[model samples]
Target chain A: MLAMRELSVGFAGGLALRRATLSVARGERLGVAGESGSGKTMLGLACLGMLPEVAVVTGSVRFDGGELVGAAERDLRRLRGQRIAMVFQEPLSALNPLRRVGELIAEPLRLHRGLSRAAALDRACALLSEVGLPDPASRLRQYPHEMSGGQRQRVTIALALACDPDLLIADEPTTALDVQVAAHILALLRALSESRRMALILISHDLRAIAAVTDRLAVLYGGDIIEEGPTADVLAAPRHPYTQGLIAARPTLSARRDRNAPLPTIPGTVPALAHLPPGCRFAGRCPVELPVCRSTRPAGNPACHRGGP
Target chain B: MLLSVEQVHRSYRMPRRRMFRAPPVIAAVQGLSLTVAQGEVLGIVGESGSGKSTLARLVMGFERPDQGRVLLNGQEAHRLPAAARRQTQMVFQDPSDSLDPRRSIGWSITEPLLAMGLRAAERHARAADLLARVGLAPADMHRYPHEFSGGQRQRIAIARAISPDPALLVADEPVAALDVSVQAQVLNLLLELNLTLGLAMLFISHDLAVVASIADRIAVMHHGRIIETGPTARIVSAPAHPYTQALFAAA
Candidate 1:
């Protein structure tokens, strides 16, 4: 129900996202995986018309046959909470300290759905229960500071779900959480998407979390989508060198191997956006880069000169 | 043993919830004990509020244990003199926070050396040498912390930690802030340093897979206690404690 064709976001620093083409169907789960400065978050922000003031956007963003690019602020505002909702990494920052949990959730419902104060509060309590928060009635009266990190995250999820959005954009939603809590949140997101028929875009630096929750994966590097395919297929057999490097670099618990050996790591760090190579973004770091890779950009699904490694 | 903690106990005072009531004390660490052999890497895995950072502080002698003893090289760690305490150094989670933004990378790396009463020429030479050792250009030492990327800044932090030629390194989530590729590089650097310099390390992290990759021994911490401790392979292959098993399962 959503599509982006050659969408790019640039500022004074340079292009943060470049000619990105992507789509997400209703109830589809798409994972955007990248490190810092990789532009994964930018993709999500662009979809919601939430880019910074200085940001210069180009190309098309179509949602349900309507163009979102250059759309009126009034139009985008109406669609934001009602149709496309977001959950951030830090739940505490997303929640207001002065307000009670019930009010936080109900405000979105009242604003978007125009429900009565009493009715909206009732829906908020149900949303809390649906998102697996215990004792929804008591929790409604509690403030954000009184809740733990995981509980706060669940409340934020409840707030997002209060409007019954068609699309949910969770940007590293579990990165700030503990391992067990993170796992729980990932599972909750997956379950909510499936049950509500809500499309999901799970953006994270963690490949394991993405692999566990997402159906399709798009690997981003230096403002470009280096690889995009089925999550299972891409993980099992990564075609791009960057994808291969990322998978190899991760320390695995289930895998059996020598402990004394150093993990395989990609040499060098990601270059600054302005200093990025003219050709392929991955050219300078790719293990098997052809000469042409340094001068000419590779245009394909894997976005590599040496495909299917 | 390079380091030992003998039944260490620590608690903190929490504000009173009710008027006219005595403030309650929460146990941060309780009767916890462990030992690290020379050149060994002991990984402490725990979630937030599980007392991992508290343990690190106790080891670094930043906070004295309310009860029990922390020993480094058979001496009370907290009682060690200023010069002697330099033998144990720390690398914190965020390099950007640990590093001074205004100072040159060389200045930050050589601060410990300066405190040791080293001459200017000697400190400069050592800083340049240490930079190369951590896989950075020696010439880049003059640049400020902002000039370097996150991974490079971390390398600078490592270089600073090892500048005093410490016998034991306490790294608290050193690679947690780094990317996967960069995380692996830093982990390998720590292992390499441990091997080449015989630097015993207490590596603490919430990431099970990361600790598994580097630690010779793994200690699972829960509710201010060591629930499980064993060789890395055994801990990874078959954890005996239910908490440890749950932690691994979550990972």
Candidate 2:
């Protein structure tokens, strides 16, 4: 299982993640939904030992029955790709400029499997084909700049799978892609989990987007998981008022927003890490907030997240 | 009568290596003609590489069309000298790349004043004034880009774009970098600015939803051509073109 037990991450700005906890099972896909700075990306980075240098993380981070949160630097490096892998938002920048497409895909193959040059090259071509690239062998010779945004993101996915790791973490992998392409990428991630039984951590701001791909969903607000449950139930009928506001705020069909209706905006901005709100973190903006919510923090109970749309 | 794009066709010839071999050419923009009245908001929607940005750069006078002309208030913009090019400004999608990080927001917004030969103190006062106009604290002038959120940074960018009080502003996917919560704020700001300044705008983006509320007229581009152009209401309700329909379906 992939798990974070009472995990805490703090920075000079303040406590960005406060005693957070969650888990994912084999072949399971968990979607983490939050606002722009709601500690979504921070959680993903913390798991891979890639958190910003200033972040001070405490508590236990474990994968496949081993502790990782406080693992030694050298041990973390070995665990990163061999056991866990991540694909970031911007694939173009993440790719090395000087390396050939083939060399880039062959990296993790060499790093973990220690495959020979010929074998790795052959596997790299296979991965390109699996990701639906045309003329997989030909694309291996091109650099990142020569490919389209969608094609380049596919390459990033190919690299992430090179190690055949137990867990895959994708952080807004399709944000820059066209909708058609984003749908294809999402389908691809689901297929990978089905065929490989790899647990996946998918993070994005779009709830409907994450719902379409995940088995379970976690709603995050101000560095805490405000709600968590089965993806279908939560999206179909959300218990949390903030989640409902997000639904109403979603861009309608045809992308035509109504000026007549007031957009259901989350009232106050997210509290800075250095300045967290008392009671429920969402009390400032929750439309149906109770008076008790502002003075007392709500416990992250699974029952509170019971099945809404 | 704020902006007019007249039959603008921009093309580039492929480099020729042999005398006998003729180089192929690529046409980025076709014979496109449009007009933006004062206080009107025009939207240009298309997939990436569909030349929406090329059209934006052309209107901003950053790229001169190979054929046809661009007129700002009945004055020629393409052939204008660099100083006159300052009359029209642009807000790019990536704020970080658009603004100079080494300098304060105040210096960046006041830059065009220097180019236009304004007195130093006058430029500072005008920039600070524009800052308030954009809903930002004037003291924010001393802050760095990293200190502000994506939406606030875009506000600064808008303040800088309109610092010279240009008749036309071209925002190229200004809110695409922000989340849904913040996209609303920026879109609302643009709408308010249009109503208040009546400034003409050429809003280019891939996200139709973000522009639908603010755009008066919508132009849908596909594969380097504007396939559909009509009022936002008409286009959204009954899109005539297949690409626009596909775009609507995606939204």
Clashing pairs in 2: A236-A308, A236-A309, A237-A308, A237-A309, A238-A308, A238-A309, A255-B209, A279-A296, B39-B198
Cα lDDT of model 1 by residue, A150-182, tens digit: 999999999888888999999999999999999
Q: How close is candidate 2 to the true structure, as a TM-score?
A: 0.86
Candidate 1 residue-wise lDDT at A235: 93
**lDDT of every predicted structure (CA atoms):** 0.93, 0.81
If you superpose only chain B onto the true chain B, what TM-score does each candidate give? 0.98, 0.92
User: B155-193, model 2: which lDDT tens digit per residue?
Assistant: 899998998787778999998887677676677777777
* lDDT comparing candidate 1 with the true structure: 0.93
lDDT of candidate 1 at residue A43, scale 0 to 100? 94
User: Candidates' TM-scores?
Assistant: 0.99, 0.86
Identify the CAPRI category of the predicted complex in candidate 2: acceptable
Question: Compared with the real two-chain complex, what DockQ does model 2 have?
Answer: 0.36
B211 in model 2: Cα distance from truth in Å? 1.9
For A1-309, candidate 2 gives per-residue lDDT tens digits of 878887778988777887789998988999999887689888898778788777798987788788877678898888787778898889989999899999998988887789988899899999999888889999999999999888999899888888888899999988888866777788888888788898899999977569768999988877888778899987877777777666666655455556544445555456667667766777766666567777777775531222222
Could you report the DockQ of all the candidates, in the order they appear? 0.81, 0.36
